[model samples]
Every structure is written in structure tokens, then in C-alpha cells.
Target: MSPFLTFKTFYTNPLNIEYFYIFLFTFLLALSLIAITYISGKIIKADKTHMAAMLLGCVFPNSGNYGAPVALFAFGAMAFDYAVIIMVIHAFLINSIGIFIASFGSEKSTTAREAMQRVIRMPVLYGALLGVLFQLLHFKLPPTIMEGISLVASATIPTVMLILGMQLAEIKPQLFALRYVNSVTVIRMVISPLLAALFVIFMPVSDTLKSVYILLAAMPVAANTTMLAIQFDVKPNLVSFTTFVTTLLSLLTIPLTIYILNMM
Candidate 1:
């Protein structure tokens, strides 16, 4: 079959329901983490330290920087819409929800107003908004402009990967203990994607959408998690480790997800 036919076939297949399952699972999983943190903070009377780490792991995924590149390579022009959807979801979560959670245990004690400001300042939001505006206006960027933007966006992935590797190489020995870091790695790299895949299976979205959602869910933790950790005085080392391990392990997990997607 031709590439388009293959995609069409994959999308139309009944197993495509798995996409909705995955999306819901990932979404619920993040929400659950927020609830857990809030409860732990209130009842268990836990300190902000643990809550911070889990929050970072729960919310951050390398959907835009890495997933977009992979989707473009695999899905061609369709990747643009997929990337947009992922960005929209991400912006909503991070701006409205993730920012609220991140504000806690943070020295700056960000109010709702401050969080809204931060949300507005997000570069990904800006880029996605402009891209969508141009798209909706039926305005095509000049070839040169399009090429320049694509070129810059294209570099985001590999550079991030290399930086992640280098960052992992620099991790402190104390931070490598299984007791402190193993659960974060497993949850971020393994459980999160598995749940996302299952969630995608049940949603009413299109088959292509299912595939895109699965791909986004399976992505590694976002590098931005570390930045958030640093900015909020969370467990930066733990967040960085989770990001590193997930990104590294994704070499295997992502291919498996692709195989499963093909079968579906």
C-alpha cells in the first residue's frame, strides 16, 4: 500500500480506539498526581519537596520538541495538525493546571495573576498561536519564512537529545539511588505512556488523532520539567534524572509503541 493508504488503513481500523484510551489515561494520570500531591500535602502533612518532584514528572512530556519531529518524519504533513493538538492540550494543562501546582513549594508563591502572566509568556504558546492564526487566516508564510521556521524547529529535537545526554552524564552520585528515583523513572517512561495508549482507545477522536495522541503520550519527559524544578525550587536532580532516563529508554519504548500502533 502507499503511505497515504497505509495511514488511512491504520486510522480506520477498529483498534484505533486505543488512541483515546491512551490520551485519557495520560490526562487522568496527570490529574491524579495533582490530587495526590494536594492530599499528601494536606493529610499526610508531607513537605513540599516530594510533591514538587512528582508534579514535575507528572506534567512534563517532550511532546513538542521531540514528538513533533518524530511525527513529521512518520506522518508527513499530517504531523502539523497533530503537533497543534498536542500543543493545545499542553498549553491548557500547563497554563491552567500545571502552573498552579508548580506555584506551590515555590519560593515566589505565585498567585493566579502571576501564573496567568507566566502562561501568556510561554514561547510554545506564542508559536502555536501564531501558527494557528496563519493557518486559519489561510495565510501562507513565504517560502523563505516557512523554511527558516521549519529549520529552527527541526533543530530543537536533536539538540535537546544531545543536551539531555550531556546533562545525564553530569548527574550527582547521590541522586542515582533507586529509592529516590526509580519510581519517577518508571512512572514517567513506562506507566504514563501505557495509560495514555489505553486512554486513546476509547475516545471519539479520529484514527489519525488516536495515533497522534499515542505518539505524544509515549514521548519522554520534557526538558522543561527541569527548568520548572529549578525555578520552583523543586527536586531538580530528580526531575532531571527522570527526563534523562525516559528520553534514553524511549529509544526502545517508542519503537514498540510504533509497532503497536501499526498493528492497531
Candidate 2:
């Protein structure tokens, strides 16, 4: 069978519904982490390092590179609209919440203007805008251009995953046990996604929207979080470790999430 057919069959299969429910459960777990972050911030008095790590963990996802392809593989063109919307939201959160957290307790803080500029300049933002514009205009890329984009974009996931693995190899296992690191992982990988899913479930969203929200929520922590941590002088190691932990954990969480959502 063709890949598209296989993708369709998988979604339609009775077993797949179980996967969907798992997605829902994981998303709820993620929301719980967000609450933890807020309460922790208040109780612990918002230490710069801890706050930054928590923020980095909570915001951003391996969406553009990892998510788009996975959506395409599992749901084909049917999933495109949902994927695009989630990507837009992801970009916004990274620029706003992610930036705020990274800047906390830092001497060289970014102003609103700087943050806006950074968001505007992000390639993901431009790519998503262009994708939506093209869809709205009903403009089609040349076969060659489409093929090229797909080929280049396809490399993004594996390249990112490999880099992430290498980075993870460098982490001292001890860091994983740190209070801040553990807190960030629980929030980023579990709480944030859950909140996003709950929003999707209650809102009058279409199935496409529901699927996209769940998929985006299930994504592991973005590698960019660590880069931002380094640039902003917010505990890069903590960010990296959180990324590693969440990404590794997502192997179980993501598949289960998809299963559960399918059932629901």
C-alpha cells in the first residue's frame, strides 16, 4: 500500500483510538506541570536559574522539524491545516513566554521591541506565514520547488534528533536529579501539552484542530530552548538536560498520547 493509504488506515483502525487517548492523558499531565511552575515560582521566590529552566522547558516544541513530518506521515494533507495553526502558536509562545523566562535574572535583558524583532526575524515564523499565505492564495509551488522544500525540510528532523542525542550524551547524569531540572521536565513535557489539549477539547474546534493541538503538545522540548538559554545566560546545562529528559521520555508519552486520543 502507498504511504498515504497506510496513514489513513492507521487512523481508521480501531487500535489507533487507544493511541489518541494516551495523547489526551499526556496533555493533561503537561498542564499539571504548568501549575507546578507557577506555584513553585511563587513559593521559591523565582530564582533566575530555576525560572529560566522552567520557562524553557514549558515553551517551544520540536514541531517544525519533528511535528510537520510526523503529521504528514500519519495524516497526510488532511493534517496540514492543524499543523500550521499549532506552529503559529508555538512560534508566538517561544518569542513571548520563552523569551521572558530566558531573560529573567539576567543583566542583559531584552526589551519588548527586541523581543518583537526577534520573533519577526525567526525563519519558522516566516515559513509558517508563507505557507499559510500560499494556502490562502491557492498558489502552487513549481514541482521542483516543492520537491526541494520537502527534501530540505525532511532533513530537519533527523539532523535535529542526532544533534540532540549528541548533546544528551554530554550531560552529567547528576544534573537530571537537580530540583530545577526535574521541575522543568514535568512542566514542559507534561503540563503545557495538557493545557493545550484541554483548550482544544472544550473549544468548538474541528478534528483537525484537535489532532494538531494534541500533536504539538506531545512534541519534545525544542533544541532552540538550549540555544536561547546559552545566549541569555540562563543555565544552558539545565535547559539542555531538560530537553534531553523530555525528548527521551516522549518516546513513551507521544505514542501513548496518540493511542489515547484515537480512542477518544
Candidate 3:
């Protein structure tokens, strides 16, 4: 079964409310990470454009495609539930908070009303809400419609990755020269997992949840951040380059992290 289906099925269980702490945990952790990255970027004297790019590339991860598989490989299929749950949270946060941050930090000055409007209009937020509602209400979609939706959902990650690769190809000659790209890469692929370890070490959740958080955090920058960048005109090339760099580096870093999580 798909990771998202696994996630939905788990939540739809009548007794699943007992595990709601995991959602709160992820929400707080995501906010903290975003805040820390935003402050750090400012402290480093990054310009608004770079700061926005840093927040976009560093705070989010490729939790669906890259993270879920890694969770399955490293911790077994049972643990995939946690990975998918975190992915859902990440998606919601990216569409709402991530978009707000990007808008606030955009090169063009934006008023509070405009930022709020952007977040409100993001379709991903609505989709996330509807997913939860459907699961909770036990609303069964028509078979053919569900199948088409599944097909489209399955295509999200690969499609974003392909777009990222193309954007990177265009920026190849100046990839390294792109301001804030390296710092964003390091923060996303390296510091994120480290912070996840620290976050989980003090939590009272089960080891399975801990493993999922670490693996999810260890994922590379979200490829869809490039799409957000392009959509918001928030330094698309720099964000895309950061996404490419971090994903390329995660091949080594993810395994290393899986080893660390295994030891814990």
C-alpha cells in the first residue's frame, strides 16, 4: 500500500486518537525548525531573498518519496506509518507556513493581508484538510476517482524532482556561486537530522516515532520548494539549486543517519 494510504488508514481507526500526540510533536518541531533557520539566516547577514530561500530549502524535507522509503528500508514497513504521518504534517506546514515565510521574505514588499491571502488560496492546504475530513468521516470516494487521485498523488514527488533537475541543469554553471545555496543544503540535509535527534531524545514517544522523526528530518530539501519559489518568485534558481545539492548529498547522509538511528 502507498505510504499515504497507510497513514490515512492508521488515523481512521476509531481508537487512533490516543496517538494524537505525534501530530502535536511534529507541529511544534516543524515550527521550531523554521524559526531557528529563519533566525540563523538573519544572524548570518543573509539578504531577504537568500533568507527566504534558506527558509524554504532548509526547513522542509522530501518526506514523501525519499523519507518514506528510507523509513521502510531502515525500520521496516511497520514504521512507514510514522513516516507517512510526518509527511502529511510536512505537506500541510509547507503549504501554509512555508508559503507565508516565502511571501514575507520575498524581494517585493508584501503586506500582511497579501501574505494571509496567499496562504488561504494555496490548494494544498485545502487538499490536506479534505484528506483529514474524508478519513475521519469515512467518506468513500468513487473507485475510479480514487484511482485517478492516487495516480496523481503518486506522481507528485517524481514530477517535482524532475522539475528540480531541469532547473538545476539551467543553473549548472553557477550552481555553487548561488548565494545561500550551500548553507541551505547543509542546514537541510545535515543539521536537520541532528536537531531531530535532539528533539526526540527528550520526548517520551515510542522508539518508532523517534526513528520516523529522525529519518524524516534527515531527508533532503523538498523538491516542491522549487515550485513554490517559482510560483512566488522567491529566488527560484537559488532554491532549486539548494534542493538539487541537498538531494544529491542525502545519498550518503541518509544512510549514515539510518545507521545512527539504528544504534539508538
Candidate 4:
């Protein structure tokens, strides 16, 4: 509802056509990474649940509050706008595809068709679709109603954070999988953005937008991954722990990535 109402204003500005390229880049890159992450799990015969947690950790990014601020500070307001576009696209995908993947890894076994069927039934899908429709229709919700939707949408993050705190309280030494944690961290902080940098080389956007894309690609594993792990009862400890570690590690890697981009 929030994303739906919020997206209604999406056309009222100097929004770039290049934004499509950025969305394409983010969507394709995420799916590619997820596929590789899943296949790697298969090669190692990982438990389905653990693999789901790792998939979330390795692919989904912190593009909302985290990536947006970094964009504002790192490259100023214009880059922040680009980052927000990326974040919106990312938020929709994570809510849909991410949810489906999490469901598949739960105790009840599910097939791809079933998982996709479940995804189709998600409200976020409709929210996004209606948003697109409303945008096309030049529709506007009354301000009060839009405000109500926005209020509900705003609560989502704090709730996800509260979930993170609860998951953190459950963390114990036995729950930490250092090998998987390190792998997720390396991929999230290093390889993913490196791939993005290469990918954007031929992209139609300017170098600045390209750099913005790379910085976002380097964001930590999303805290929402923790929420999904908790929701599905799928190795909540490992997923949250990886989220924490990747976030802490990003403090160092983000600056290094920035410097590397400068060199490029």
C-alpha cells in the first residue's frame, strides 16, 4: 500500500530514462547471483534451509536507509535519487522473489512452480502492479489516504529492525558458521560490486550513475533478510549473524570500494 501510493508520484519529475537501465542491472545481477549461490549450495550438498539463508545473505542488498544515505554523502543529491530508484526496485524484488525463496526452504517442501505460485499471491506484487497502474492512469489517492498508506509503509523498517534485535539476542557461539559468514561477506562486500563495476562499463548510463550502482551493489546484506529468515524459520541465526557481520565489515569495504572506483 505504501509503495503503491508512493509510486504514484514517480512520474512527476525529471526522472531519467537511464533509470530503466539501472533497474535492469539490479534485477539481472540479483538473479544471476542467486542462481550461482544456489548452484554452489548444490555442489556442496548444503541443507535447503541454510542455502536459502545464504542466498539472502549473498544477494540481497541494503539499498534503502543504508545505501541511500551513502549515496547522498558519497555523491550528493542526484546520486541519492538514483539510489532511491534502485532501492525501490530492489525492495519489490526482495519482497516477492526473496519471499518465495524463503518459503521454499521452510520445513514443508515446495517445487519451483509452487514457489512461484506463492509469489504471485503476495500482496506486494499487487502493490507494485497497482502502483505501476496508478502511475500510468495519472491517479492520486486523497492526501489523507496516501498519508495513511505511508504511515503503514514507514512501520515496516522499524519492525524489521526489531526482528533483527530479537534475532541478535538468540545468537550463540554454536550458531555462527564462520565459513559461510566469510563467504557471504566477501561476496557482498567485494565480488558483487566488482561484477557491477564491470557490468556498468557497457551500460548506457553516465559514469556517475555507474559508480552509484557499484556503491549500492557493495551494500551489506539487507536486514530484511533477517526478517525473512525469522519468518520462515530457516536458520535465523546464520542469516542474522551474516547480516550483522556484513554490515560491520561494510564500514571498511565501502571506503575501499570508493577508492577503487576512483582509481578506475
Candidate 5:
């Protein structure tokens, strides 16, 4: 419940210093996956929309609803703080870098100014910054206010899942037959996690934090990819398909990954 305690330990304790590296690793791993997928799509002579779809799918993971709960279950509530940090990094990256890539890769020509505007318009980064500021400053709110915040936060996951379902309903039937679908799936559900595992091995964090990282790595494509794709007109159907497929695939992969990590 006291994430500030974990954040404090992260800075003051030598053994926990790797917590800073976790943010770097998560951001770099995501960028690396996006780069790999984008290049692979180019090498394969994929179309603009398909390549954009690859960016959307491979660059982001469902770190919130899917990753948080899995971390809570596998590593308990303490690890949930690590998951929150990962998700915060994930959100910032998705809002800025993710949007830029999706916009640039799309069929339309996006200027740097436009991209900058899109990134600035996103509130996640500001929210994350304010949250950390409050934690660092030991700012306390009333219990009644905290309770209301908790109540609203509890609805986030289900609301995201509902949005995903609605996005699926918007997918055209023809996109299902696209040949690039398998490639997107492979990049998202397979290669991304493998890259994350390498980071996990090298990270100096505790075993529980390592487990949280790996589990978050194995999560499905971000459900928000669909919304971003739709917003940027960046091959929404393919993005939605990859989101749906990767999420369905994770039902098997995530649990199996948890068991494997335990055995390791």
C-alpha cells in the first residue's frame, strides 16, 4: 500500500539501486522491439499500413490490466509497486514515443510539430510526474478523498477491457485475412518477452522484481494500441487484430510464464 516506502528504498539502498535501471530497461526494451519489428516489416516489403500496425502492436504491452494483476498474483502486493512503476514508464513511452511512431508510420505525413503537440496533449505523463512529486514530497490527502480515488481506479481495468471489446467490434472482417497478422503476433507475444528476459537477467533487482519484469514482458499488446491506431488512422484493423490475438494468446502464455519463472 505504501509505494513511497518502496520508492524511498529504491534510492537509498545499494541493493535496490537497480530500480532506477528498471525504468531505463523497460523504455529501451520497448524501443528496441519497435525498431526490430519496423525493420523486419520493411525487409519483408510490407505496406505502409502493415508496417504501422507492427509499430503499434510491438511497441506497447497491456501492462495495466493484464500485467498488474498477474504481478499481484505471482509476486504479491509488494511487487505490485514494481508493476506500477513499469506501467508508468510504459504509459509515458506510449503517450510520447508510441504516438510519434504510429503517426509517422501512418499513411499521412505527420510533421514534427504535430507529433510534439500530440505528445504534449497526452495527460499520462503529467499525471505520472505529479504522482511522483507528491510521493517524494510526502504530500498527504484526506482519507475520504483517497477512498474516492481508489473507487475510480478500481474501474480502470474493466473499462479498458470494455474499450478493447468495442474496438474489436469496429474491426472490418477483411482485415482478418491479412498475411501480416502472424508476423505481428510473433513480434508482440514472442520476441518482445524474449528481449525483456534478457533485460531481466542483467538487471540487479531482487528476484521478485525480476519476476515482475518478466511477467510484464510476457503480457499482450497494449489495449490502448487500438485506440491510438484508430486515432492516427494507422491501420486500426491490423492493430486491433494484433491486440486481440496477443491478448488471447497471453491467457496461455502468461500463466505458463509464471510457472516457468517459479521453477527457475
Candidate 6:
């Protein structure tokens, strides 16, 4: 279950204006990455499928499963709140803009209107929206129901980890292409965090929140991206391979990113 459905920890609180900074920062991050990927694709004369894979790998990140836990451990429970807020924003952007990119990259060839129709049909986007709407109306689910929803949400971590493993396992080692894999990993693991570090400098937020955002941006190529690539037939192998490589690279990059942020 997507955490967006969790009524309590996720959306029960009234919306905070401070959250806008998180939204803005992530939006800028996604836009910058999309531009970089798109422009770089044009430079390399790459096809739409490969560019889409690059966009997914570079723009969206594994903020939910990988990043949230890292925040809890690295900065204590306080920073975890910042992480979830960012995760919610990430989910919305990825599900909406991500669908557009995937559909555009598909061999079936879609019109712009058709792409938006796909985005609208996504239930996850509606879940998040409905959650926000409920919050604005000061509506709360009964405690008995909230507990049941929380129970399902609690299972998300383990289930997602299992799915992550399954996705990686399905990748054929022989099909791995080094040059493209390196390209995506460098953008995801290196460039994304640097851009985040700079983005947070001007954001009106606590230092702790800034650090949390940077670390989340520094996370690996999103696991969700591989599934999207597979579904759209948009270089699934390259996306999967890049996901695998960036994840392995994060073991080094995350710790280093944390250390550098602390020094600042």
C-alpha cells in the first residue's frame, strides 16, 4: 500500500506552509533533471526510449523505502517527518509527470491528451489528493479505521524491499550496457545531490530539514522507475541495470553526502 493512504501520520496534520519549500525544491530538482536528460539526449542523438529511461533514472529517486529509513537512522526521528513530506511530493510528481514521460516513450505512440488521460486514471494520484482534501476539511477517520489503515501501511516497507529484490533479480547480467549505465548513475548519484545541496541553500527551512532533503535527493535511481520502464517498454534493461548500479554506489555516496552536509 502507498503511504499516501495512511490517514494519520501522513495527512492527518493540517497543511503547513513550510512544506511549500520542500515542494518547490523537489519540483526544481525534477525540472532540472528533465532538462538535463532531454538536452543530453538531443546531444547524443538518442532515441525517445533511452531518453525516457534516463529521465526516470535521473529524476525520480528511491525516497520512500530507501530514503525514509536512512533519515530515521541518520538524523533521528525528527528528520523522518521531513523525509515523508518529501516522499509524498515525490510520489505525486513521479506518478503524474512520470506517466507522461513513459507513455511518450512507448512504441504505441500516444498524443499529449492521451498521456494526460493516463495520468488522470492513476489511482495513487487520487489517493494523495483525497488525503489532502480531507486534511483541508479537517476531517479525520475514526480511530478504529485509522488503526487498520496504519496496519496496512506498516507492511509497505517489507513488501517494497521484496519487490526491489525481485526487480533486480530479473535483470539479465549479460544485457548490461556499461556506458549508458554509467551515464545514469553519474547523474543520479553525483549530480542530483549537488543540485540539491545548492537548492537548499536558499530555501527557508531549518538546517535539519535541509540536510534531510539533500540526503533524500542523493538516493539511488528509484525502484519504481524500473517497473515503469518495463511496463512502457522503455529500455527496461538499462533502467534496471542503472537502478542496480546506483543502489550499490549509494552505499558509498550516501555516507559521504551525509558527512559533507554535516561539515557545511
- Give lDDT per model, in order: 0.63, 0.63, 0.72, 0.74, 0.73, 0.79
Winner of 1 and 6 under TM-score:
6
**lDDT tens digits by residue: candidate 5, 1-264:** 223322332322233466578888988898788789878888778877778778878878888757876787788867776876788678778877877777776766667787678667755555555565666666776778666556655555466556656765665545464557777788878888788888887887789888888888888888888778888898787777777778778889988999988998
- lDDT per residue (tens digit) for residues 1-264 in model 4: 335423532533345678678778888889878877877677666787878888988889988657766776788767766776677778777877888778878975546686566556655446656666666787767889777666775465455445545655665544565667767787788778978987897798877788889999999998778778887887888887787777778879989887887787
For model 4, give the 10-residue run with minimal summed lDDT. 4-13
Ranking by lDDT: 6, 4, 5, 3, 2, 1
Per-model clash counts, in order, read 19, 25, 0, 0, 0, 0
lDDT of 2 by residue, 98-171 (tens): 77768874667789888888887765656654554565566666778666566665555466547666766776
| lDDT (C-alpha) at residue 108 in model 2 | 70
Candidate 1: where are CA atoms >4 Å away? 1-29, 32-46, 139-170
Error of 4 at 250 (Å): 0.5
4 or 5, which is superior by lDDT? 4
TM-score of each: 0.73, 0.73, 0.77, 0.76, 0.83, 0.87
lDDT of 6 at 223: 86
Task: Give lDDT tens digits, candidate 6, residues 74-181.
Answer: 997668767777887887777778877887788866667865776677655666677777788778788898788778866766776677777777766556555567
Candidate 6 at residue 20, lDDT? 82
Query: How well is each residue in 1-264 modelled by candidate 1, as lDDT tens digits?
Result: 112222222232233444344445556857754664455445544467766676677556777567766776766656545554564456557666666666775776878898788777765555545554554566655778655555665455577557656666775544554643555566666666676667766676667767777677678877766777778777777777777777788899888887788788
Candidate 3 has its poorest 10 consecutive residues by lDDT at 6-15
Instruction: Show pairs that collide, candidate 3.
Output: none
**Candidate 1: Cα lDDT at 85:** 52
The predictions' CA RMSDs to the true structure, in order, are: 7.0, 7.5, 4.0, 4.1, 4.1, 2.4
lDDT, residue 169, model 2: 76
